[model samples]
Target: MSLSVTKKRSLAALAAACLASVALPATPALAQKVKNKTPAAEASASSVDYVVTIPSVEAVQSSMDEATITDILSGNLAGNAAALAELDATSITIPEITVTLDVEVDGETERGTLTLSNLVLEDVSDGVATSMRLNGSSFATPEGNADMGTISAENVNLAAILGIYGLVDAGASREMQTLYTDFLVGGGSFSSDEFSCDIGAISGGEVRGRPFETSFVEIISIAQSMEDNPEDISPELLGKFVRMYADLLTAFESSEFTFDGLDCAGTTDEGEALAISVAGITMAGMSPGIYPQLSFDGLSIVADDGTMALENFTLKQFDLSSVIATLEAAPELVEESWFEANGRGLIPAFEGFSFSGLSMDIEDQDNEGERIIADVAEFDLSLGQYLNGIPSALDTWARGLRVDLPEDSEDEQVQQLLALGITTIDAGFRIAAAWNADTNTIDVEEVSMSGVDLASVALKGTIANATEALFSLDMDEAMTAGMGMAVKALSVDVVDSGLSDIVLAVVSAEQKVDPKTLRPVFAGLAEGTVVGMMAGVADAAKLGSALSSFIAGKAKSLNISVEAKDDPGLSLEDFMMAEDDPTTLLGKVNIDASAK
Candidate 1:
């Protein structure tokens, strides 16, 4: 049996418990009710336990003649809400207890034990208990065992859990209902024959589950009882389950949770030791339109021959307000025809996501000693002001992306590149844009890629007459939209910090000459070529002068821009046709050029 299953069965057994004849401690408020008297001392004539004979709920039935309870009924399964309402005590406490379950594993039955210390159910009001707690908890099975420091829950919906809602005013139903305000689990550990884990504290708050009015446990019981053909489910059954999904954002509107740390160690199939560790994960501020911010600072995977590590990761501003709103407007979308009507439209608004300091190192002995390694400083994407599930503004970038090339390479190109002190393409890249739906225009703010000690070239432009038809699937419609767009403004800017000088050096090295001697020689050749190519242009000499100065290393930057004279400036189709004729294209627009 899995550790999770053992935990559930063991806890369920204690939930349907053993009554001890002893006085138990209570809070200051309930202290008056528990004045050194036994738990049943105040038990009215209405007190009764009806769910006396369920399988996992029966603790001592497997090894002994009966459970730890004082009495046993032969054939009842669960109690009704009416029976639950008869309880009059402010609290119910049980001594340290142990429950054994007959676990099924590999078609055979084995033993699992769940031990809980000093369990308490307090602040009974209506048909619910306001809180529940246990000092310590542990679950043990043949496969593995887990021990926890403490377990507790506050504002627990006891009525729903005890099957009170299974039968409602109308009669029996299947709508599942569960709600709780806060839940906490202290440090814990799990160990098996080949693997072991150490888990830190966990916490949850403002948790809302399925909004259905039915009982949660009964739904599980029905699902478990189904033998075969479970996939051949009815639409009504599917709809009921789907409606239960709509309440998630509405449930965790103000919920927050955290995981402190987890460290697990095991072995690979070849018996090589491997371990995984994660720490400092927190999530907060989850609501309909706002996604919870989740972040972690430490994570790593280590093996005998390799390791992977990350400094931090964070994701936030994933908004599902539109999806939730769409469902509320047409709850029928969750029914049998979900895919056609609703599933395709479930795009969440992405606001931001990022990670930092990622590194990987792997040495594979099976692949002739080949190694795979990488280091990335940061990567991020951010967007805002969504329209029709599209972000109106977006910015994304990747910085310091790097990977090494082997020194002993088979390819001649690799050897030549390495001979020039070039290894990996350690570079950064960025692209940013904004769309104005009201104006039918898009502004590409910036697009650039830059390498270490290399050149940076950026392009920015504005396009007008961009319409919703551009988002269509039909090729003809999209093509028509593209043809209709006009260039409002465009510019290219280049910053050659060292790329030009390095290229000159490479050429000089091949020719056995000094790079300083080639600068002016190459510059004059470039200028003469440019003027010859544009002999008939009005600004040929001026453009040639700037190009020559830039190549001679006398100028480190070059810029060029094209701007429309008026509205409906230059259509892309017209620009493409006239692109080969510089004189005609220049006559249609204003050109700006400079070098510095």
Candidate 2:
């Protein structure tokens, strides 16, 4: 039985999105806000609790487990390891799916585990058709449990052509492979170190108009204690963990599933830990088609760290718009090299859908070893090219038909803009800190970048003692302070090799000081000598003047000058930072220090 064309196309789209990803930074797992509710008051709230709704859960689940379809295309049995085209019992009994959660909670400690069981899958296709179902499911937690969730399915499949898992050859198997690949390309996977559940179910209308089907059921841990201590959640480790899970989830959502409904619930031993529950959901493809519309009623997460447990926790909607916008913003993120390495037989549409919006919290230990709790948000994702009209035969024949060109027309222009944007970024994050008792005062010593002010850019010069050099100026405090703190007295000496001649020069300035005072502030200054010390103040002043003259002579030997009224312009040392002279764009400018 040959699958229809629509099913095949749907499957291809799913596969493309999955396999072509490259350099996808892990998404940190954290709750996002729902639109309708007021920002949950932070007064008693110590953690975020969020609820999410999903639609077309069954359709999406089918696509998530497309690996079964891939097995069919690659000439293998379903879950039992039977040969492709061979008949296992048409119907195999699948156990009911159950999720068990175990948790331990103290005043400030939380730990838990979730177990899933009884997941059944059916073999509905021999390269011609595919289908599956989800039995009744329930959840059990240490605190309590629920039985209000159900998993269902509908008609689904990818393009007809199938052969190898990623290779598209022409034949019955090839057709099956193509369809399977398509579904996987568009659909994604739900995987975890503790558990994994994926079903690739491609859905489309049949000749007789029968619908496609697929579904999923699984368990997730509510919370856990860090290896070091309950209060010490390693931010670094937590960040990495959240990012991995988020990336995997994103890959699944982009696949063939159009979510309809999803419900999840869990609780902890201590009421202050957190309680999360979600149900009623919907989702749909970007464009209109038979693809299911996914929606969820309510999804929520509550965090109680002996502080305040977040109430009315909700993740109303997944920001698909933001996902799409990110793709549009950075296409190179999904390169052909990445698609080739990971995508193999996937389509181009899935090439560059960037994965983002992962967040987590960890215990930050200070130098003194006191713990400072902080939440870190991480964005790790990638994007790639989109396939349009198939290229010419010659292009395909020269190598494989895989297209490596940029998806957008203005790729070069966009890259240039990105480069320019970061040029001044480093000059932004410098600070000077002073500690007084329990309080610390940090002054902005330089520039600030990223708004949060985490790092500082030091304008260091690596001059090779060149007679003349130029550089760019970043409008920051380091540049300003260095100029303001110039000495009030100096010396100069210039030696000209030509004619074997030498010229000596001196310069001085007085700092204003009041005469009438209990302790007179010294008015004149010299290098390595001070005046106005009690009875011998006259002799000290004379000695200070002689020292000042000598110092002035030495300072005058070197010529340094500041350009007047130069607003954010390039400086002399700027050229030293570059491989080529910046002045090449404007020609040469001379410097004179003869004191005339």
Candidate 3:
């Protein structure tokens, strides 16, 4: 049935009842019929009913005073007393409101359908406002979840949120007053399921605020203002505010957050305008620790008319439960004691980290220079249980780590280095180490690098008393407790003919220097001269010349070894601070050199 026809019939029935009351007088037959129909049966007969109204701001405000409105908007009255009280105390106005509800009854079931054509909240003292509209909203029976359809909102200012919580301050700047979210359109359904509620993707929307140097500073400033006033604020609530500020600071200080698949722009406090848009952003397993597992996918940044981007970046596996727990317990903390207790309490625990497919291309518009591009294929760092009072190990490796040099390089130093057999350099390094608490030692199982080797080289060593020296924080004692401190072997195998010739050329050039001519200059110095007294140069020169000739003529592949003699362990302090001849410090150690 048409709504207009239903409305006409209702009005006609009311006119008939009025005429009967005046002319026919009250009849027992009419009263019997009215009493015969039950309220539910009567409502059922009417089936679908529609009500349309344009409610004024004052009317809306008065309606919010109703218990049902108050309960629905501000949870339960008992637990949300503060919110209810705030609602009653604050002055709110709606410039325009149009609501349409189509309520229907079938058997014992009742359903409500709502469509909002326009909604505007204005006349706020803080100059904040909002406008929203919804189409085809449906309510489930028995006060169940509402299913929203194509909802849109505009001019959702931050001040409105603050004002709702009674946090609006008149002294705040316009920037703080004017910061707002742009138009957003989304739809979602609320149901009785864990994490099932989903707000559909936003096609396009942005939240903007006054360009402050940092969000941390701005939030802290607002918190400080509230602290100074202390009106209507409980100590516990204040502590919570401080705690949130501290968490924000800690997160910003510790982690690198990457954003992708977002359209963003902002102005810095220094008045520099910046803008960036990306395909998407992924920050995986971020935590407040020294080693946080994080990742970014398809990231891009636009700056100074140029772009820097990465395909994927990741840091793997670390626990941040301690940090989160500390932050969550802020409300129970004593006021004015938060900073003192947590300022230096950060301890990081991490498992692994990695990076891959990073690239950058930058252009200097001001200088009209060529675009500079650089790329990296992969980089990774991994750790196994360190510093948690557990046995720990570490492994790191990298591949295809290179930089693209400009065809016409601008820097003279870079060009010079490239000229000397260094072009489009590729390099990689690998390190593996383990800590043994039982033996109090750190065993470096392997340390190797490529692209800087005349021959394949590997270094293996152990730091004796590693646990005590590192964890005990007593350098002097650790230096004097050296034990079993000797290199087991030192060897190198020439793998490239060109690198072998370079080594031979360097040694032969050194041998060609006239040792006799170099000896006289040191020999002519007096016994008390600065050079003679400082280094014993006259006696060292003769020994150095003989050793140089021996190395140049006999050394094909070099090896060296040192064993602790039958004496006390070497004292690092004595070796560094000794004022006597340098060789005197080596008297307590044995040395061997060989060439084969």
Best by TM-score: 1
lDDT (10s digit) by residue, model 1, range 32-148: 011111245532221112121223332211221223221221111233334443233366555555555553433456666666666666765654557767787777878899888
Candidate 2: count the clashes. 141
| TM-scores, each model vs. reference | 0.75, 0.24, 0.44
What is the overall TM-score of model 3 with all chains considered together?
0.44
Give the distance in Å from residue 343's predicted Cα in candidate 3 to where it truly belongs. Answer: 4.9
Q: Cα miss at 236, model 3 (Å)?
A: 8.5
Lowest summed lDDT across 10 adjacent residues in model 1 is found at 25-34
Residue-level lDDT tens digits of model 2 in 378-427:
21112222212111011000101111222232457534433323211111
For residues 1-596, what per-residue lDDT tens digits would candidate 3 score against the true structure?
A: 01111121232222222221111111101110111123444442333333323343332443144333222221122233323223321333323222232333344434443333323333322233344333324443344454544443455443333432223332333232222333333444555322123334233233333322223224444444463345555566566565564454333211233332444555445655555544544444223333344555666676665677777767675555445555556666345566456532333346666777777777845436777666667777777654422226888877666766655777887785455445565556678888777976667776766554434344555544455444322445545444333232222222231344444444446768554344344324422242333353233344343334333433334333333344333445545545665666444444444344
* lDDT, each prediction: 0.63, 0.26, 0.43
**Top-lDDT candidate index:** 1
Order of candidate numbers by TM-score, starting with the best: 1, 3, 2
The whole-model C-alpha lDDT of candidate 3 against the native structure comes to: 0.43
Model 1 spans > 4 angstroms off: 1-90, 96-111, 123-131, 153-183, 204-241, 289-291, 329-338, 364-368, 388-392, 410-416, 472-486, 535-542, 564-589
